[model samples]
Each structure stands twice: as structure tokens, then as C-alpha cells.
Target: MSKLTQLFKKAQSNYDNYLKRDNVDGLEETIKAFEKISQSELNATLKKATLTELQNCNEVLFLIAKSYTAYAFAKQKELSYTDAVDSLTKANQCYQDITNYIAKIPPFSLPLDLGRQNTEAEFYKHKMKFEQAKMEQFFIKHKMTGAYDAEKAYEALQNIATAYSTFQRVLEKSYKYISYKIDFGINDELTNSIKDELSEARTLLAQAKNKKSKRRADETPTSKKNDNGNTQKKRRLRQRVIIEEESEQIESLSSINHSKEEEDTYEIPASEQEKRQATSESLPTAMELSQSQPVPLQGLDLLSTLAMSFFAPPQNVSSPLPRMSSTLENSITAQPQLENTNVFWNQNSTHIKDSQECNRLLNEWSLIYFNSLSTPVSEKDNQALTLERLGHALLLAAARLQKESQFFGQQKINPALRIAVQLLSRSAELSTKHFNPELTMKELSAQYAPLLKAFANPGRQLYNLEYLQHLRRQVYKESLLINTREASVTDIVTASFKALANTCFGKDYEIVRDTCFEALLSATYALSKNNHI
Candidate 1:
């Protein structure tokens, strides 16, 4: 017999032994033995093993790859997600190459672990399963804090939905053609996970569309507000017109209303007129006035008086932040009056560079924004852009620190992440997009994603993950993890009652009643279990 046939037979024997132990699906030995055979030079010699033997080897590889994918789902093992995904990817790629290698081989009696022959439907099922796992991994890793923007999220979800449809077709075909045994639970799991990340991704996509539509609607064909080329001229022109109109109206109103004596009292002075003209010449071109010109002792008061004059400002009124539309600041929340946000922009990142240079290029912008966080989002004309940019800066900084752990030793974890949650939350209110990239390959290891999502789009969204408890499902798991203590069972019971008694049952509270109560009940039971009886 050829060396290839001998090796394939030996690997088949090992896989046979493993299956006898009641693992109908191939497991540890099946993977190792077939993997060695695949790496061998004999695998390239198609004539070494009979056509039937080659098909059997391919079936074994498919089963192994399927097991690896299930392992990645956290349905198996407590290890980091890196190991799981790598195994799945390697197995998936290997199976794909080998399948192509034997593509010319005709369908035959490829015996299965189920005492029946494998069919073409089996191949289709394996392909769909692998694709679904990959999409899930992608969605989890890139859902919030990474370079995975709304479009990526939307596409990944669509792919997941496609998998769901494929599985349904696979089951129906299997039944119709008497193919390999298909499990009903396959449909259940697909329906559950693919629900295409379900409403969350769709909601983000919808909100993104709305933001774009609103932006386009707000655009004026006459004015170039979105133009970065000549914002200074626009600002200067707007101020000049406002000042001139105010001066003219005041002079005309006084000309009709006042007598000669009264006219003396209201008469415009030459110095004042010159000052108004000069002020008209300069109304603090965007925020550049803060950096270039020294504010006089009462410049803020003077500027405020200049700004709030005469005409009620329209929705598209000019703002002090360069190239940022004032309409974008419609519902800005006040900046958190915290210590880090006071001046230097610490955990909060409230301060930034005092110039327009940061927006010139992506790399330079990233650098400047990363190094300096001296700007407040609330004060920006485009508060949404400011918030998203600052959040991205923090996310980038966190990712760097994570990468630098080898040389820098352990780093503080939550400060940047916590602040980023706040920023992204406000940004999502204005525009439902988090323009960041993957922090890590692992799905759950990227915890910042859930926190960011929960903050940004949180409003009574149901999270049905059985793995995480109430604290993590509906709230920040980080804070709950800290200072956890063993309280008496009675204490937990009493606390629950006290909470219920004190809480008001208004319409806003109604939205979260079930979510909060589930959390409370689960927390109480868990604490009771962890504590002394």
C-alpha cells in the first residue's frame, strides 16, 4: 500500500477510536492525526489514497472545523478568545484548501459518524456554519469602539442574516433529499444569534441615516457652511452684516421717536460709531479670537453683548468653532463639571489644542488630539463631531496602552474607557456612530464595546444574554465588581424592599422596571449564594 493510504488509514483508526468514546463529532485526536496527514507530502499525491479514502478525510476535517467553531462560541473552555478564534480560523482555512484540492472527486459512499453516507448537503452545512461563526466574531470585536463603523456593523449583520437563511435551506434540502442528519437546534441558535445582531444594528443604521438626512436637510444651497476653505470670510461677513443692520435700525428708530432734546440723549458718538465699525470688522472669527487676540478685562461681556443683539438667531446662525455648523449643537448637554475636565483634560478630555490645525490631516489630527485634550465638546459648534473625535482619541490612547503592556507593565484600565463612554453617549445622541476600530480579537474581551453601546444607545433595550448577570446585562459590570462584599441574606432582602419602596413608578421608570427588577432579583440571589446562609 502507498504511504499516503497507510497514513490515512492510521488517522482514520484514531478518529474511529475517539468516536467510539461517544463523541460522534471528531474531537482532539481526530484533529491532530488529520492535521499531520494534511501537512504530509503524501496529501499532494491524489492517487496515493483511493478516491473514497480522500473523501473520508475531507469529512473528518469538516467535523473537526465545526467543533472548533463551537469552541469559539464560549460553549466550550474558559480560555481567552484569541486561542478559540485562531483555532477556528486555522481549521476553517485548512478545510477550505483541502476541499478545493479534492473538488474533482465525484460524490460517493462517504460513510459518516451517523452510520450513513455523507451528502453534498453536509458540505454546504459546514460552509455555512464556519461563515456564521466568523461573522459573529467580527460583530462582537467591532460592534462599538473600533474602526467598525455603522456601515461595517450593518454589513456584518446582513451576513449573519444570510447565514440564518442558508441554514433554513440546508435543513429543508436535507429533509427533501434524505441527506445527512440535521439538528433542529441549528435553526434555533441561528434564529437567536442572527435576530442579524437583530434590532441593535438596524437601530444604529437607522439613526445614521437620520443623521445624514438631517444634515443634508439643514444644508443651504446659498451658504457654504460646510466649507472649510473660507470660514473666516463667512464669519466676518455674518458679523459685519449683523452689526451694520443693528446700527442702521437703532439710528432709524431713534430718528422717528425722539424730540431734539431726546435726540441729544440718544445721539450716536463718533468714537462709539468707530468702535462699532471696528467691532463689525472683527466679531471674533470663530474661536481663533481666543488664541490670537488678547481678551480685554471685559471682553467676554463685550462679546456676549455683541452676540445676542437685535435679530433672534436662526437655526443656521454662525458659531465660534471653525467649519462646524451651529445647527449641530442643537441639544448639547453641559460638560461634566469634574476635576479632570476642569482645565488640563484628563480622564474627561475636555480641553484641546487652541487652533484649527488639528483638523488638517488624519495622522496629524490623531497625534494632536491624542497628546492634547484641552477642548470642551459642549462648547463646539458641531458638538456631535467634537464628542465623537474626543471619544476616538481616548479609545486610541487606551488601545496603545494595552499594546504597550509588555514594556510599560500593568496600566490603569478604566479611566480612559469610562470617560469615553460619556463622550460617545453624547455623540450617539447627536449622531449614532462610534468611529473606532477593534481593540482586540476576542469578542467579550473587548468589554469597552458593551459599555459604549449601553451608554450611547441605552434606552430599555433588552439584552437576553444568559451568560451575563443583571449587573452586566443592564448596567456597568465594572462598578459592580468593585467593593463587592458578603452581606446577610436578610440585608439583600431588605435592600430590595427599600429600593422598591423609594422608587417612583413614573412612565420613564416603567420602561426599566422589568430590567431593573430582574437585576435586583438576580443580584440578591447571587449575593445570597456567595454569602453565609
Candidate 2:
């Protein structure tokens, strides 16, 4: 081969080698070498070459841009924020040049490879914008409270919002081309990431606005005391101003939700809204109640109240009672009231044990993890980790139930088991829906299998296993049919209950039915407590 051809071939081999390495420092050194070559022999060769030669030069630029973008991502993963931002800026400029160069070539004359390069360039351009926005967000987060500048923070947030908007627009425009060329769903990832960033930016903007409003309100003049001081009048005026400020704060929060509602109205279809409403209605009222209340009601007290409401007969008799009948009625009522009051007092005297506190903490963390899954930017790895932790929580809860079963009978263990199953099944369904490997689903299922066996009858283990597999298959199929749209927690819980009802339980079928009903009630209560619905 000629010296010129040999040089090009060596450069291509080196580029391919650098692309495979994971070390950012090595990649940086390779980039420097390429730049030196590009400035000397490559520049001279490019100046004298034809259209075909210019296309080859553009290919070289494409490789360089890709390397720079990869290095930027590595730096980001390392949390070297400033260096990552600088790398991304340079990468973006390189991609922009590639985009402009390809646009100048006639459509009829443009090679297929050039079209692919152009799509890649557009992808990196938007990708870099997203990275830059993230860097700004990181900077804002690390700023010290004492040194924080409200104006600077607001400006950073605004820039991030703008970046998200522009990145979204670019992705939407180029998605089809990129999808065809890349043979993967770039559009979905870009859309979800940008949507999350935009939501965060808007939230920060609202907070900033609220802070500014509060400051202004605090600075407003209050009435001064006169020489013949009417202190009462001044106090009343101050109270009225405080009330007005509180009302304004409420109005601001309502306005934010109102705007979100309007946006949701356009995006959410009628069918989806109906599904959501049905799920919300089915969720337990206790969950909503708990969200409002400072402390959760004791499990025993809640169960007692539910039992009384469900089992108490109506008393419609209004006849005047004989002395003996009245005395008997008073004695019966007083006895249960006295017993219940004494039980409540006794229960109050005992402190919560370490095990119970640990259990409570586990449940709280599991709920938080579940809530985090709702965020658009949540990753598959994070989701898997959360699910694994939930599995551990389930095991801990099962152990507690097993201990309780020794004292309270198997029937008493039913409610806790049902909740654990619902949580496990939902996590499994999510793992599948998000395209997690079958191994992840299998590992989660394996973790919960022992608990499932502990709850199921010996003769019904096969049936329970079949039902679980079927539920997972159905969830996966439905997710695929719906393009992997997320199912609500209510829907997941309801489906799990339905599965439990349908599964064969041998001689314990009646117990299973009771368990399902209790689970439904408890789920509704939990949902209500959290105001999740």
C-alpha cells in the first residue's frame, strides 16, 4: 500500500483499539495523538483531496467526537464534574461540525455511511446538552447555604430547563432517523431522561419563586404602635397579614398543581384516566389517613375497630327497659369498655422493642424505594437493587410473622404474608417490565419462594408456584402489549389479590379467601394512609 493509505489504515486501527478500552486516561492520550496527526499530515492531505477524501476526513472527525463523548461520560461517572463539562462542550462542537458538513453534501451524493454519521452526530449533540445540564445541577447542589446566591441558582435552573427543552425537541426531530440507523429505542431513553430533568428544574423554579415571595412578604411593613398605643389593633393587623400570607402560599401550591393537571389532561388518554380512577378507588382508606395523621394507629387498635364495624349488629329497639334488662345491658357495655381501656393502657406501658423498630424502619425504607421507582429517571440497576432490598425486608417480615404464628395461629399470619406476597410480586413484575434479565426476576422469586412455601399448604405449593409464574407471564405480556407502560401499585396489589383468590389452597381455600379480603382492606388502608391514591 502507498504511505498515505498505510497512514490512514494505522489511524483506523488505533481508533478501533482506543474505542475498546475502559480507561479514560488512555483515551485522553489517544485523543491527543489523533489531534497532533490531524493538525499536521492529516490536514495537508485533506486540503488536497476530493469529495471522497473529505468524506473520509469527516469519518475521522466522527471517531474523534465519539471518543471525546465517551471520555466525557467516564468523567461524569467519576464525578469529575468540571472536566466532564469541558469534554462535553468540545464533543458537542465536533459533532456540530460533522452535522454541518453532512448537510452541505447533496442528498443524492450522500453515502449511507455519511447519513449514519450525521444521525450519530445529532444524538451526541443532544446527549452533550443533557450532560451539561446535569453538571449545572450538580454545581447548584454543592453550593454552600451561606455562600449561595439566589440569582445565580435561579439562572442555573433556568439554563437547565432550557437545555431540557432543546434536547427534547432535537430528540423528537431526529428519533426516527436514529432509530432506523441504530436499531434500538434511543427515543424512549432520551424522552424519559429529559422529562425527568425538566420536572426537577420546574420544581426548583417553583421553590425559588416561593422563597422570593416569602422574603418579600416578610419585608412588608406592619403597623407601628401610636403614642396612645392601641397595641390590640396592631396585633389584629399582624394576624390578618399572617393569614393573608398563608393563603397566598396555598394559592401558589394550588397553581402549580393546576398547571400540572392541565398538562396531564392532554397527555393522559380517557382509558388511562379511567384505569387510574378505578385503582385509586380500590386503594385502602387507611393509607390516605396515615399520610395526614402525625402517628400511625396501632395495628391492634385498627383491627379492633374494623372488627367492631364489620360484626356489630344494628340496635333498633326503642322500648322502655325493665330495671333488670337495663342493668344487664349497662353491665355488658361497661365490661367490654373496661377491658378495652385496660388493654390499651397496658399496651401503652410497654416500649416498642428493638425488633419492632427495625421492622418499622425496613417498611419505611421499602416504601421510600417504591416511591423512587415512580421517578422517570430511575435506572434498571437501581430498581433491581431496591427490589433486592425489598426482598430482604419481606424475609424479615416473614420471620416476624412465623414467630407470631406460634402465638396467634396461622390465620393471624395471613395478613402479613399477603402483604409480603403483594410486594414481592409487584417488584418481580416491575423487574420484568423494565427489561431486567430473567436472572434478576429468578433471583427475586427465589428469595420469596421460601416465604411463599411457609404460607401455602403442603399440597398447594405446586398450584401456588403455577399461579405465580402465570401472574408474572401475564404482567410481562401486558407490559409488552402496552409498550412497557407502568402499572399503578393499586393495580399490582389488586391483581396479586385476584391471583391469590384463584390459586388452589387445598383444604385452606377458605383461609385463602379470608386472607385475600383482609389484604384488600389493609392495602386500601395503607394507600389511604399515604394519600397515594
Candidate 3:
């Protein structure tokens, strides 16, 4: 082989070795060494050169450098903008290095070789893109807020970004192309089947809830007690009907068998016979009836509840009779003593030994709870009637407690009676104040007014029936004129009688002795004698 061929072979081997380097530092160093050796060979060729020889050397060196640039980039440890720019810079330097060699040659009468310009253009294009990518990294990845000078720095970067047919063209080459596909593991048929099962389960759950709600509704004390009372009343009616049917059947049989004898010779004596006949006539049969069907005695269930509460000592109830020293017991007996007895209620009240005081306190507490109501009872508003009923129940319970708590033959005044009187008085006042004029307040007064009158009566000494009669008379009189479009003095007196009837338990003297009626009727009569009943 020629010496030139040997040197060329040596340079090729070294260039190949440089191409194998992947690390930036090693690749760059090897590239520099290869360039230096090639340049030395080109220089030696130029020094002795024939034109053909020089042209061959220049072409060979150019091809070698271009091949090395591409190879160095391929073996790059990391393919990023920084390394790309660095490689482009090295390639530009190699081209510039050849410029010096070309400058020494005679000027050619050729247009400027646009290849250098094109190469420079491509290098600048990539450089701008790299810088823009770095800026984009700052904006998109790092979430930078400040302004980016991408205009001055990477003008062609925007054009390159827009030309991308795919993410692979980007300087970073790290973008992902994301897409989605429906998972048909569950489809229309499966979905419909699940819906059917879910609907059926929901229906069953609703049925269960309804059944539970109905059971709870049935168990409410009001409905259950009303049903039980009605049932008992029905049973009594059935018994009464049976008795009347049997009696009528017996009378008919007797009358059919001995009609003439029953009329002519059935009497032992005139008076005795008449008496028996009269008794038979008076007796209610299947046909003959009386007004006001008797109300069947339905024993109060609440009384039973109260008895259970009284006799069965709850954990918190303190029995005053047993005289226990427990804190719970002290709490109960001390309720009347506490200025604010509202705090220690059911828990300590069970221990209450003094039945009278306990009853009184309970009634008082109930009345207080009732008096706390606001008006125009809406769904959201507290109900006045509920509180009033609670007070009534408490009073009824207190009555029982009063009797239960008394010692055998130890006649002590029932404090509950006083409390009952006070509560009734307050209830009457509230009823008068807020009660609709159309509704007869007499119903409430009928229950409580007699008790008041009995308390106020001078003759009874134990009761004051006179003052009660006076108060009730006023209530009735006022109620009568309250709503009357054309009420006169007469209306006031008539109402007073109705009030008297309810208050005095239908006693004849209730109507006669009412003070307001006496005054009202007297004035009416004085004005017109025909106005008297």
C-alpha cells in the first residue's frame, strides 16, 4: 500500500474508535483528536499538491468530518438540546476550519456554495428549538409564572413546534400520546340484570321499612288505647243487646201463652200488679231506648302506668319511705325543696317519699312546661294542646299519687290538691285568653270548675264551691258574648246557666246560685219581666 493510503487507513481506524464513544467528555475529546489528525493529513497533501490531489484531499476530509459528526451524535450518552447544540457547534467549527483551507486557494468564479448557509441554517434551527424547549420546560413542567423571552431567544422555535406531525419531532421527545377504550367486561345485558336485581332489593327494603313503620304506628299509646277502649265499649254494647234480646223473647213468650190470664188474673194485688207492670214497662228491651248511651268504664291506662312508676322503683327513683341515704334518693325527696326543680326530674323524683309534695311538684312542672308554648302552632312550632294534655295527665296522676302517698288514717292535706287547683285556674285563664270564641271553653271548665266550686263552698268547709261558681259564671258569660254578632244581656245569663250546669256537676243550685246570672238576669228582668225563663 502507498504511504498516503496507510495514513488514510490509520486516520479511518482512529475516527472509527472515536465514533464508539458514548460519553460526552470522551466523544468530544476523540472527535477533537480525529479532526486534528485529518487536518494534518490535508495540510501535507496541500503542501505538495497537484490540483486533483488537493481536490481529493479536501473532499475526503469533508466526508470524514461529516461522518464523525453524525456518529458522535448517535453515540451521545443523553440526546438533549444541550448536547445537540454542542455537536452542531463542533460541526460548524469543522466547516469553519475548512474555510481557512479554502481561503488559501485561488478565488473560484462560482456562486457562493449555499450548502454552508443551509448547514448554518439547520444548526440555528435546532439551536432555537432547544432553547425554546428549555423555556417550555420552565413554563409547563415547572409552572413558572414570570415572562419568557422566547421571542428574542427562539424565533424559529414556534414554526418548528407547529410543524410537528407527532410528538417525536419535539426537542424533548418525551411526550405521551394518550387514548381510551371502553371496557366491555360489563355491557348492556349485564347492566340491565344488575339494575333489575338492585330494583327488586330496593322494593323489598321499602316493604320492610313500611311494615316496621306500620308496626310502630300501631304501637303508639294513643291509637292502641283508643282501639282498646272502643273494643271494650263494643263488647259492653254487645252484652247489653244480648240481654235486651233475651228479655224481649221471654216477655213475648209469656204474653203469647197467657194473654187473657196476664190481663185478668195475673195480679196478686192492684198496687203490686201495677208495680210489676210498671217495672216491666220501664225496663229497656230490644225496642225501647234512652238518651245518652252510657259510656263504658274504660279504666285509665295512664293510672296503671303511674302505678307501675310508683310501685316499681326505677334505678334513679329515690323512695322517701325507705329513707335511703343514696344520692338518687336525696334528689327525689328534695325536688320540692329545689327552687329549680326542673333539673332533677324522673331520675330523682322516683325516690320521693312524700307523695303529696311529689304529685304537686310534678303537676307544677307539667304546667310550667305547657306555659312555655309559642302561638299559631305550625309544623315547626311547639304545640300548645300537647303541653296542655300533658298537664292534664300529670294532674290525673297526681290525684292517684295523693291517695297512694297518704299514711293509713294519717289525714294530711294533699299538696297536690292545691297544685291541681292552681293549674286548673291557670289553664282556665289561658283558655279564656287564646281559645277561639267558637269553641266552647265550657268543656274544660266542666272538668275543673266543680272542683273549684267544691273547694270554695262555705258549707262543705273542705271546698270553696261558691267562689268556683262565681268564677265559672263569669267565664260562661264572657264566652257567650265573645262571638255573638247580636248579643244582649239575655245571652250572658243563658251562658251563665250552661256554665253552672258544667261546673256544679248538674246540681240544680248551680244555675240558681250563680252570682253573675243573679245580677245579669235581675237587670234583664227589671228591664223586661217577659225576659225571665
Cα lDDT computed for each candidate against the true fold = 0.34, 0.43, 0.31
Model 2 TM-score is 0.37
Q: Stretches of candidate 2 above 4 Å error?
A: 1-21, 37-47, 77-82, 103-108, 144-146, 177-187, 214-533
Top candidate (lDDT) = 2
Poorly placed runs, candidate 3 (over 4 Å): 1-7, 14-30, 35-53, 75-83, 96-533
lDDT of 2 by residue, 312-359 (tens): 232332221110000101101111111001122223321123223333
User: How many Å off is the CA of 438 in candidate 2?
Assistant: 34
lDDT of 2 at 146: 39
Lowest lDDT 10-residue stretch of candidate 3: 322-331
Q: Which regions in candidate 1 have their CA more than 4 angstroms from the true location?
A: 1-42, 45-47, 75-86, 93-138, 145-148, 166-533
| Candidate 1 C-alpha lDDT tens digits along 1-533 | 43333333333333333323334233444444444554455356544556555544444444444444433443223333334434455554544444454444443432221111122323433443434444343434433443334333333333333334333443443333211222112334444654545344445545434443445445413322333444567778767666766676676555446334333432211110001111111122112223232212121122223222311233432211100000011111111221111232133221122111122222333333333445533322244444455445444433443344342224433333443444444343343232111111112224335433323222223233211122122223122211111222223223322222223122322222333333334433454455432
Per-residue lDDT for 1-533 in model 3, tens only?
Answer: 22232233334333333333332343344354444444465456555655444333433344334433444345333333333334444443444444444445443421132222222223222332223322222222111123323222121222222222111122122111110001101124433543443343334333433444455445433311123344556778867756766676676565456445433421212010000011122122112112213221111222122222222222342211100000100101111111112222343321223223333433444344434445444421222232234234334433343344433113222222323332333333234343221122334545545334432323323222224323322222211211111222233223322332332232222222332223333333443433232
**How many backbone collisions does model 2 have?**
17
In candidate 3, clashing pairs total 18
Strongest candidate by TM-score: 2
